[model samples]
Target chain A: MTEAVELWLVRHAEARDARPGESDAARALTERGVRGARRLRRALRRLGASFDRLDHSPLLRAVETADVLAPLASATRVNAGLAREPGPEFLSDLASEVARSHVARLALVGHEPWLGQLAFWLVSGWSVREPARQPAWLALEKGGALRLRGEIAPGRMRLEHALDSETVRALARR
Target chain B: MLHLAQRLDELRAHAAIARVGADSRGVHRARATAGRIAAWLDLGGWSVLADDVRWLRRGLARARDLDVIVESAELAPDARAWFARERAAEQARVVVLLDDERFAALLAALAELPEPRGKHVRRALERMQRRSLRAGDALERAVEPLDAAHRLRRRLRRLRHALEWLELPAPVLRAAQTELGELHDRAALLGALERSPFERATRAGRDARANELEGRLASFRLRWPALRGELRRD
Candidate 1:
């Protein structure tokens, strides 16, 4: 039996510009990015955000953001799967993982396009067959987070709200 | 095996200086001591204090950065004055951190830490060594190696500290750390020079710093192979 889950899908904060010859994955967060992530953490705490687990991409920026928000989760792990784009199998695996772990709430910190695409899929359904047919309404900015609730299966989840980085920071300041 | 008490004493002493409005050296020492304590805590399996240590370090970060920039980078006189003023403003934030309630709780936790069990020490050192090796491997494959090198530098520091705690010699690790440290400093200087105003006055100095950065990068690339080999042996 699967329990309803609250999934917080987060995009990693603004990354520093890559130096010459640097890999994209090796780029770390800028100082401003760190501050933004910390503010997001504080805002989440203020709103009483809690999660069963925090999973982040293996990439440096996501890992760093995850570290800042780790106090919200009971446990944290580096999920290499998050470093890749989501597909149908990805959602299936996620559903199974959530069921097995009994995770009622989870936070996923990852990169763009991937996170945007995942959020799109969860809110909309597989009815949009081609990737090109998907709407752009779910795009997330750096440091933004989307809160989804309900079943873990794709297309079944409800989009509670999507917050931009600025809003989150403003909320945090309040 | 960490002398938690001694480490805490060092943090307190340096933090006292920092809280009173730190000079550049005081900021450096306070930050370094806090980092050492954090690393020691990691090695000893004191996971509870991780957040506190991270919070403390984050609070000190700006102060440390300004200190390093002032000490290592060549700035136009006007730029130097501007940075000094900014640094002075930042000291107030650092002082506030020292008086924060979380800091007091961190101190109390450090005071109560027990010596790590002997069995855990070897396991912990092995874990740290593995992490360092992974970081070194990432550095080799990195397209932009500077950021990777910086990450490796941090892992290397933790490994060196763990070895020191165990009374083991780590001369190669120490040497590699120093080389990486110089490279990082040069890179920081180049970055600061790039952003500073008074560009016309600072151009020659910036170009010189750029060349220095390239030289250090090349030197580090040459040394990394042998360093990785040493890490593998350990």
Candidate 2:
């Protein structure tokens, strides 16, 4: 078997508040968002974080997030499997893909519902449709990241640690 | 915009405790043990019964890695004592990583995924596929070079990893891996014997080791037709 994989799941940094009819995918990061993302880089280094590869949603905020945290690789990747309204099937496919990514440490920079639903499905194989059986939902704040290490196989991963934005800011203070 | 030096000062004084839990430790060993169990489901099934032993191995390795990390890091006196005790307790205890229920859960959940493998995943899978093909070609040569044969074994092992990831059937690749692995081991043993002091001191020892290696090599060759046939069938 390949080595155990580490997924550093991240939500994109703050973005400009949307304009009326402004496509969410076209929305760029605000100045504050950029600063927050740079801080994220500092925080990752502080935590001794490194990655073999990274992926992001095609949306602008997510792409910029990936650029700031982890520069885009040579290959153009498809969506990170994190839709704004992700469901069980999406998260399941994400895990299935993760299982095959073969990377020792892969960082996925994307959006919320993807990370939240993913957190749920990872800890418990059930999704929101079966919320009665789902475990606690993990909230990954903007500029926050969770370090997960294990099999990407459903219900097999253990959340090694989760750091909220406040916690990360605190950690990055020095 | 920043108070960077002070920030560094605060974090340098203390580190987070590493005693996450039994669940976090031994992930690799646990999954491998589970695989071994799955592989031997219909056989004598000692693999299933040996679950406790696998857990023990996992616990030991996790605790050791934890201790090594803590001992090597700078920490407050209080933190050091806390880690020392945790390490001691960790060293003394063991835990099972997977039960039959979780194993079945993993299989079931993954089986239901709706999408085809993602782009990065598929690229990696195709790379392994190509490598396995090359290995197969190496094995099919008119006079297979030992090095090429060794590569075939490595390629098969890699193909197994990819297949396992894809949840594809891998017994054929695994069987080929086992055969090539044994062949490599015997070849290595012969190399070691050739380098031994006793073998160097006596011509008889040298000749005996050569004969043993030749016998094993011939036996390994005898399996080729069967291996080729197996690969063809798969």
Candidate 3:
């Protein structure tokens, strides 16, 4: 059976471009991205996001972002499968991880393209009939996060909303 | 599990969905608002009427296999109006079917399954690659009917989809597709030019346009192998 969970997919704050030869995995978040992460934290709290657990990719930027938002959730960990591009298998791993926590909601901090891909997959499979063109590839700007609510299964989740940093900040301020 | 599956089915059948699968996964329901009983399927044909909802079997998911490979039965209707209404007045009561520990196992079980999505993508990619090679041979030979640039463009697009599904790095393939798409557009325009009433009006000037189109086409072809090479990193 499918579980209805509020899954929040967070793209890491901005990171400096990998120095000429620096490995992308080693790069840390930029100061502004750090601010965005902070804003994300405030926003999640304000929105009363009850995340049972939070995890991020091993990459420095994603780890840092998770650290910034750590206050919103009870615990944080480096979830291996969340690190790179989220293939269909990654999703299964994630859903299983959430189920283990036994929480209806969880937060995932990670990189782009993958996050967007997951978001796209969750909203609907690549083939969708729509009023709004379900993202073929969602572009979640730096520090942006998308909320999915409804049944959690392979392709049963629904796109609740996409939040920008300022929106989070404003919501938090409220 | 059985109860939850039944509930999910009821939701999909009675309610309007937000985003469904990216490629082929089926429709999913957004939490609906209060007092908003789907009075009738007002959206359009193939869409259910809210007033008299008759849920289909497709809406029901697998209780045994937690990871559902849900397919949207159809992707033609525009459900924007209904969705917008749902958004405006949603007072949805949220629910979660599986507890945390169980949820975790179900998700992981899906991944560890004999033929998970990743494996499925691999198979799909292999099939697309075989088809691409056949298309490539025809493309290289510039076979008359099959040699059309549009056909090649279509082939590239399918290959791109497979690459995406497989989560493979596809910049080169993307660039190739874009170039082919542009070439297809130019070829189409050139063909249209030849058939237009204007072509007879200026028959003598047409050769210059044709030469330019052919030149671009040849250049695109010359670049195809290099682009194709980038995708073959086996």
Task: List the candidate numbers ranked by TM-score, top first.
Answer: 1, 3, 2
The digit string of per-residue lDDT tens for model 3 on A67-171 reads: 677767765555656655666666667667577767687788887667777777677666322315545336687888889886655468888878876677787
Q: For model 1, how does the per-residue alpha-carbon lDDT over B58-138 read when each residue is reduced to its tens digit?
A: 888888777777765456667878777778999889988888755765675456444667776778888888888888878
In terms of lDDT, which candidate is strongest? 1
DockQ metric, candidate 3? 0.01
Q: Where does candidate 3 stray beyond 4 Å?
A: A127-137, B1-234
Scored against the true structure, residue B62 in model 2 reaches a CA lDDT of 48
Order the candidates by lDDT, highest first. Answer: 1, 2, 3
Task: Output the TM-score of candidate 2.
Answer: 0.40
Q: State which candidate has the highest TM-score.
A: 1
The runs of at least 3 residues in candidate 2 whose Cα sits more than 4 Å from the true structure, single-residue gaps closed, are A1-3, A71-76, A84-101, A131-137, B1-234
Give candidate 2's total backbone clashes: 3
Instruction: Name the docking class for model 1.
Output: incorrect
Please name the candidate that would achieve the greatest DockQ relative to the true structure. 2
DockQ of each: 0.02, 0.03, 0.01
What value does the lDDT take at residue B216 in candidate 2?
Answer: 59
Compose the digit string of candidate 2's lDDT tens values, residues B1-234.
122233223222211112233333333334333333322221211111123233323444545444443454333455446555665666334322222222222232222222233564556556656666666666556374567778877666655644554567767778778877666655554443344433444456446655775565556556666765675555
Least accurate stretch of 10 residues (summed lDDT) in model 3 chain B?
B39-48
**Per-residue alpha-carbon lDDT of model 2 for A31-57, expressed as tens digits?**
888888878888888887887666566
